[model samples]
Target: MDEKRLCLAHDDSLRMLRLARRCDDLVLAPAPARVLRDADGSIDPAALVAALPNELFAPTAQNPVDLRFDDDASRSGCSLVRSCPGLLRLPDDAYLEVLTAEGDPLCVCGSTVAHVLVEAGPLAMTSAAVTLGRAVGAGRLSRDAALVRLTGFAMELCGRYARDPLAPLVGDVVHDIEPVSSVRELRAFLDEPTGLHGVELARMAASYANDGSGSTMETCWYGVFCLPPRLGGAHLTRPLQNVALDWPAEAAGLVSHERMRPDFHWPRYETACEHQGGDHTSEQALEEDSRRARDYELCHIHYLPLTKKDARDVNAVTALLAQLLSIIAPYETDAFARRARRMLNDEGVCAARRVLLAQLLPPRLRWCDGDA
Candidate 1:
């Protein structure tokens, strides 16, 4: 953020520009001379490489760095390097499209890399999510994995002031947007015809994805409730995620906190659900959860809190599904409950969630044994 330092958009910045190439060329580092250009405002590979730190160019194949144009007209190619690390790549056509937006996407400062705030965060996330869908279509990544990331990224974006370190780098990249509204934005991006792969799968996930998950665990639980039976989910009505719960006169004096937000809220059914991870099991935490549940009850809302143990058990999840279905739709309760309960242990579901947690969960909370 310091304006004086040469700051290039680090890894995965949507604003970062690259010499476009085929899929094969994407992983291989570009020969310095080939990518660095003497053309107006562009880079010169050799000199820039010498001046830049090795960290700038060492990003993993998953998330590559972007090269930018030179700041000075006189020395068009020796731009200094300011880089960080993250992962995303814009397809050739999509990369060029954003530059034409109203304001200048890139703002260079100093003799080296300049700090940049690209509005293209949403664009990059959308592309990254859908582009991964391409792997799903090709049998590379499971639908569960792709869906978890897409939905997880969406939730992080929707958390307003809260940023999860485990979430994609986009949490800080974009400004004001909610979960469902962001979904609309994603669809809008997809609406424009482009060569992005996995369009169909991307569309489906966007429809099911919502905002406002408080943690990775909540996201896992939310994913369980919303995805269809065929896709290893309970197929329940998608709940409003981490929405506000207003205190009624009867519920007053129940809790000292001025604001209350549940992990999942369903207005029509008057129901709410919370995922209690290990962090919530302390005596103080349990007592607070008890008080909050009482407050929710006082407010005439059904509060359902599930811990990590319940998530690992199929029977427990099935019963929970039955309860959820009964509240949301009595007619479909038993059959849907039975069918979807098996998803808790399904390989695809477990694998998907496992990878998601590994990538996004903070080191202290990560686990690979199963979904939690």
Candidate 2:
């Protein structure tokens, strides 16, 4: 990392420390440098510490002599080292930053001259994956959900925001985090016996995790299609993401010269679905889309185009899904509906389903009456 970036990150860290000081019980944990930098860049300091307890650490001296402050209290960094009885032993370099009641910095812990660096700055997908892996290992979050969140966050940074330089780095990091063949092994490693949240982690790992999603909308769409019927989704088979289509040699001129990777594909039904964004409005993009559709038609594949409006409009998306499900398996729609009804009896899961549905469906068209 450059000195300028490091100084900015340090300033952000100090800002976080000031906010954390306002809550008497909260203590800043030793986080990866990327986490600190991203936290500094993306979220407010107060919001970052919102969930932490006010008095997480209490002042304690490792040696009694060090606790005595002569004329300069600033010299005694030990004044801020609180020894909480149940807290785990922190790293040797870990030191608390003490601040006044009004959020002014008092002094840094004298035990260490500076904060420890865990990873490089200039956040990348690998940094996110590492942070997520640690969070799962520590039982702070569910593995599947954390992966989805990480992928979505990285996509926003690298794609929608035009951070083009980070694109290749993000792809490489994602590959390292979730190789095509070792997804199960990766999940196992993330959920290894931490003895704290092992059961929850294992459960989440067992649940369907669509690591293949390429964007935030795709991730959300995947959840809508693959989540169990009990969770207000169709519980359909997982779709392959970014699959390439082989076009006939004569039709090569029609397809986009760039690439022909479909957003989501169902191999068994020879069907594919694409979620079109605002970029599709251009004449050139529309021409490309029509060519792709023609190619799929020629190959006897069903092509479905889902617009951003459709994604946000629950009635439209679900209606289209129901039609597709009927085409896929006419007899199974009733079974899926029944499962959704059973899910409604459990208030907790039903509430979660409602929250997810609200994101994909408009308020008036949101799922109700145990409808799938």
Candidate 3:
């Protein structure tokens, strides 16, 4: 719509708000605001005057504030202001009294005054109503359009989250596991050890040399499928388990899994001591175990350290925060935002991050063993 038209509608809305506010305050005053009833026993002034302060009254009064009720146009059962011009100019209290009396005013002067007030009431609040009304009206945009834009925004945010400094580094890489599930799958993968010819051969490569002999099938799977869609659109379920862990979990080390076992399964050939039983499993063993193989759900899509530029920077952190903010913002809705504002300037961001981490944590991590 053109600016002029939009402004007009907004103005109408503002007026409505002001009228509502006035009606509400006037009704609750110590003295009860009463209205007159016509001969047919209808409340001539309508119940709107009482309903106003309670906020129970509709935004659109029974009759247009600018125009009095029309018999055919309104349910309020009154004639339009043009037809009752004498009643429009009455002072607020005097007109309300005549309305309560439900009869023609005893004097012509009273009628003229009542007519004027009715017109003035609506006009007084028109501008403010328009601005607020326009905002409420504009917010009803198509949800489908919103979803599409949000989805794109989500993807951009995920990239930032993937690059956060708090994320794990490569050399600290202590764990690695195969993508296979059952023994049958393990045997199949081991048997078909593609091109390389050693015990610890590379199953995937990220870059190819001048000869172009090497391929990045593994890296491709890791990047495209391993990372979760923090936004929307992509639909790869259980992406974490699908991740193919390289010898060292680097940025491209992990691939997305359709589903993963709760525990990172170790091969039977790997020594039992190495599997779960080790001499180091002594004092504070439980704490070590808790951190060893995180429950699958606790895993987040992250780049492993490999490049020399794997250092922290402010801009990078800010970008990551932006993306994390988007993902968690929906949950930190109006109610949550209110509480957060009282707590910190970045309350929404902090709340979102906390909520996201809580969601990522496995059920086991929610509590620690203690005396009950």
Candidate that scores best on TM-score: 1
- How much RMSD separates candidate 3 from the native structure? 27.1
For model 2, the run of ten residues with the poorest summed lDDT: 1-10
Which residue pairs come into collision in candidate 2? 24-54, 25-54, 25-55, 25-56, 26-54, 58-82, 59-82, 60-82
Question: What lDDT does candidate 1 reach at residue 332?
Answer: 53
Ranking by TM-score: 1, 2, 3
TM-score of 2: 0.48
Which residue runs of candidate 2 sit more than 4 Å off their true CA positions? 1-182, 198-206, 248-258, 330-353, 358-372
Cα lDDT tens digits, model 1, 234-342, are 6667788767777787657765667777888888788888777658868998788878877777788888887765555444555676667666654455765555446
| Strongest candidate by lDDT | 1
Clashes of 3: 39
lDDT of 3 by residue, 212-326 (tens): 0011111222222222233111112212222233332442234233233321111211100111223444777656544433322134322121111111222222243333333
How many clashes (backbone N, Cα, C below 3 Å) per candidate?
9, 8, 39
Residue 75 lDDT in candidate 2: 27
Candidate 3: where are CA atoms >4 Å away? 1-43, 54-318, 321-372
